[model samples]
Target: MKSSYFTTLIQLLLLGAKNPIKLSTSDLAISIDKTQQTASMHLLFLEKNNMIARYKIDGDDVIQISASGLKYLLSVNQKIQSAFDDNSSTLVTGKVFSGLGEGAYYISLSGYKKQFISKLGYEPYPGTLNLKLSSNLHKQFIENLSNVDGIIIEGFTDKKRTYGNVICYPSIIDSNIQGSVILIERTHHDSSVVELISPTFLRKKLKLKDGDEVKVNISV
Candidate 1:
C-alpha cells in the first residue's frame, strides 16, 4: 500500500482502533485531521487492501488492525531504525600527528573563525589535531567522507590570498570530547590525514601526543 494509507492506519491504531474496538468515522476524522468522508474512504481502502478488518458488534462499527497491517508497520519501523543506525555514528581510527603549523595560522583567521563559530556552534582553538589513519580501510573511509557534502564553511579572500572552503563533519573524540573532522579545499595533507578542530586544545585535553591512537566518532 501507499505510505499515506499506512499513515492513516497508524493514526487509527493510535486512536485505540485495534483488537476489534469500537471506532466511528467521525472520531477517526478528528483524530486524522480529515473530514468524515475522507476518513470513511480511508477505512474502505484499508479494508479492501486487507490491512484492516471492519465489522459490527451488536450493531456498532468495530475496527481492528489485521496481522498483515501489523507486519507492515513492523517492517517500516525496522527499516527506519536501520537507517538511523547507519547514519548516527561512524568510527574512524587513527594516530595523532603534528601538522606543518599551517593549521594554527589559517584557523586563527577572522574570516574562517567567525563562520566556524556560527555554523559549528563553537569557536575553534587556534590549531587543529592531525590524525594519520591506522590502516588502508580507515583511509578509504576518510576518502569516502571527503566526497560527501558536509557542514560548509565558505571561503573568503583577503589582501594576501583567497582561502578555499572547508567541509566539516561533527565528531566526538574518544567518545567524550566534541570536535569536527574538517576537509579543506586546499591542503598539504592527503585523504589519509584527517584534520580535526575543536573548542579546546585536543592534544592537551586528551593528553595525546604523536603516535597516540585515537578514535573519532563522526556523525554523518
Candidate 2:
C-alpha cells in the first residue's frame, strides 16, 4: 500500500488505544514492507501533534495511535490486509549451515535436513535436546562403544552441502579410542547433526567417548 494508506492503517489499529503493541521503527517498516525512514517519519509527525504519544518500557519505545489518527486511517484497507498476511517467512530472513568433523562436537542450525523428517507446521526450533561424549582414551574406542543403546552416526555435511541419513553410531565406526569411552546419541535424526543445539556441544566439551569401561556415579 502507499505510504499515506499504510500509515493510516497503523493509525486505525492504534487509534484511541490505551497501551498499544510495543514496536520499533524497524518493526513498523517490516510489518508494512515500507522503508524504515518512511515509517519513522510518519510516526514522528503523528507524535509531534499529540495524535500519538510515545512511551518507554524495558528499554523500548512504544506508541499509542490517537483517536484522531484513527479517523484519518479508517479509509485505508489494502495496507491493513498486507500487514496481517505476513508470516514467519518474513520475520527471520537469515538461516545458518553447519557440519561435524573428527574428534569434535558442536551444535549448529545450518542445513535443511530437519525439514525432511518433521511434520508440516512443526517448528523445529526451541527444542532442547543433545548428545554427550567424554574420554581421554585414544585406542580401543570401537570395542568400548558396544554397550551404548540406540547410538547412531552419520556424516553431517558433505563437500557438496549434502548429508547422509542418520544411522546407529555402532553401525559405523570411524575409529575408536583406547583410553576413553565415546558416548553417542548420533542415532537420533538430529541428535548428532552438527552441534545444532547447546546440549550436544556441551557433550563434546565433556570429552566422553561412546562407551568406555569406567566407574559410574549418579547424584542429584
Candidate 3:
C-alpha cells in the first residue's frame, strides 16, 4: 500500500484507536486534514488490506488497528532508526600528545592483543597514539562516547597484575586511516586525553608530531 494509507493508520493510532474505540469519519478527517469522504475511503482501504479491524458497538462505529498494522508501523520505525544510525558520525579535533610511554607495554601483552585482533579485526601496533582535546566541546564528546556502547576488550589476569577492561570506538583519522579510540578502565590521563590504536604506527604513517592537529571521525 502507499505511504498515505499508512499515514491514516498512524492517525488512527494517535487518536487512541489502537484498541476498539468509537471514532467518527468527521473526527478522523479532521485529524488527517482530509474530507470525510477521503477519510472513509482510507478506512475502507485499510480494512480491505487487513491493516485495521472495523466493527460496531451499541450501533456506533468502532475501529481498531490490527496486529498486522502494528507490525507494519514497527518495521517502518526500525527503518527510520537504522537510517539515522547509518548517517550518525561525530568529528573531533585534537592535537597529538605524548603519553607516559606505557602504551607499548599494555598493547604488547598477549591478553589484550588477542582480544584486539579478534574483536577489533586488526592487530594493533605496539604503541598508542595519544591526543589532547583542542577545546571543551571536543572533550565533552569523548565524555559522551564513554556512556555509549562500543567494541569491548575484556580485561584478563596473568601470573602477575590484573589488567582492566577497555572500550574502543571505531574511527577514521584524516579521512583515510582507520583506527579506534580506546578508553582504558585504569589510566593516568584525565578526560581530555584520547588514546587511539591502529594496525600501523600512527606517528610514522600519518607523519605526525607532538603538536600536530588532527581530525578524527568517530562512529557512535
Candidate 4:
C-alpha cells in the first residue's frame, strides 16, 4: 500500500509540475499533503529501490520519477479506479488494527461468501487515502483469512488525529458474522467507537458480524 501510494504521489508530482518535472522534497510534500519527513522517507526508499533519480545541480536538489516509478504508477492507477461506480466509501469502524505511527488507517471486512473492497480510492489528507474495494478483490481477503494484520475502514470525520498507532478490533459486531479489524497510525490509544466509517455499507456488503475476525498472511 505504501509503495503504491508513493507511485501515485510521484506521478501527481511529475504531472503537476511545469512539465520539466524537477521538484524538491518540500515541494512534493505540499502537493501530496504529507509531512516533509514522510515524503522524504518515501523518496529515499524509492531512490534505493531504483524507482527514482536524485540529482544535485548547483545547490538545488531535485528528484525525478524513473521508469520503475512510472510503471508502478500505471499499476497503482489501475487499482485506484472502478469498473463502474466506486464504492470504497464503505469502511469498518472500531479500534486500531496493527502498525506503527498515528497516521495510517486500514479496514478489512469479511463475508460468509464475499469481499467488499474495490479498486477505486481517493486521497483526502497527507497520510490517508480512502479505499473502496470491489467484490472481485473479495477473494484476496479470504486468502488472508488466517494470517496476521487486519484490514482498514473509512469514516466521515472533520478531525483526524491520533496520539499513537491503533489496532481497532470491533468491540461490537453482529452474530451471523464474517470478519472485522481496524488499522490506525498510532502506537496505541483508548477510545470507544460509536460508528466506524461505513458500518452500514460493510454490514450489507461484506455481511459481517460482531464476533468475526480479519487476518491475513503476508505470503501465499
Query: Could you say which candidate leads in TM-score?
Result: 1
CA RMSD (A), model 2 = 20.2
Candidate 1 per-residue C-alpha lDDT over 103-220 given as tens digits, one digit per residue, 9 for 90 to 100: 9999999999999999999999999999999789878888888777799999999999999999999999988998999999999788799999999899999999999999999988
Q: In model 3, where is the ten-residue run with the lowest total lDDT?
A: 85-94
Residue range 40-137, candidate 4, lDDT tens digits: 88777777877677887776876666777667767856776762234322223232232232222333312101122331122212121122223334
lDDT of 1 at 113: 92
- Which scores greater on TM-score, model 2 or model 3? 3
Ranking by lDDT: 3, 1, 4, 2
What is the TM-score ranking, best to worst? 1, 3, 4, 2
Error at 114, model 2, angstroms: 67
Point out the higher-scoring one by TM-score: 3 or 4: 3
Q: What are the runs in model 1 whose C-alpha is more than 4 Å off?
A: 1-69, 72-76
Candidate 2 CA-lDDT value: 0.40
Error of 1 at 49 (Å): 19
Positional deviation of 62 in candidate 3, in angstroms? 12
Which residue pairs show collisions in model 3? none
lDDT per model vs. reference: 0.90, 0.40, 0.91, 0.42
**Which residue runs of candidate 4 sit more than 4 Å off their true CA positions?**
1-20, 79-220
Task: Give TM per candidate.
Answer: 0.67, 0.28, 0.67, 0.32
Candidate 1 backbone collisions, by pair: none
Task: Give the Å error, residue 2, model 1.
Answer: 24
lDDT (10s digit) by residue, model 2, range 1-220: 3467545455537433445767788877776677999888777777776567778889887777767655555544556666666421111011122223422222123433243123112222222222222332312332333444422334466466544432222111112211111233333322222122221232244353533222211000
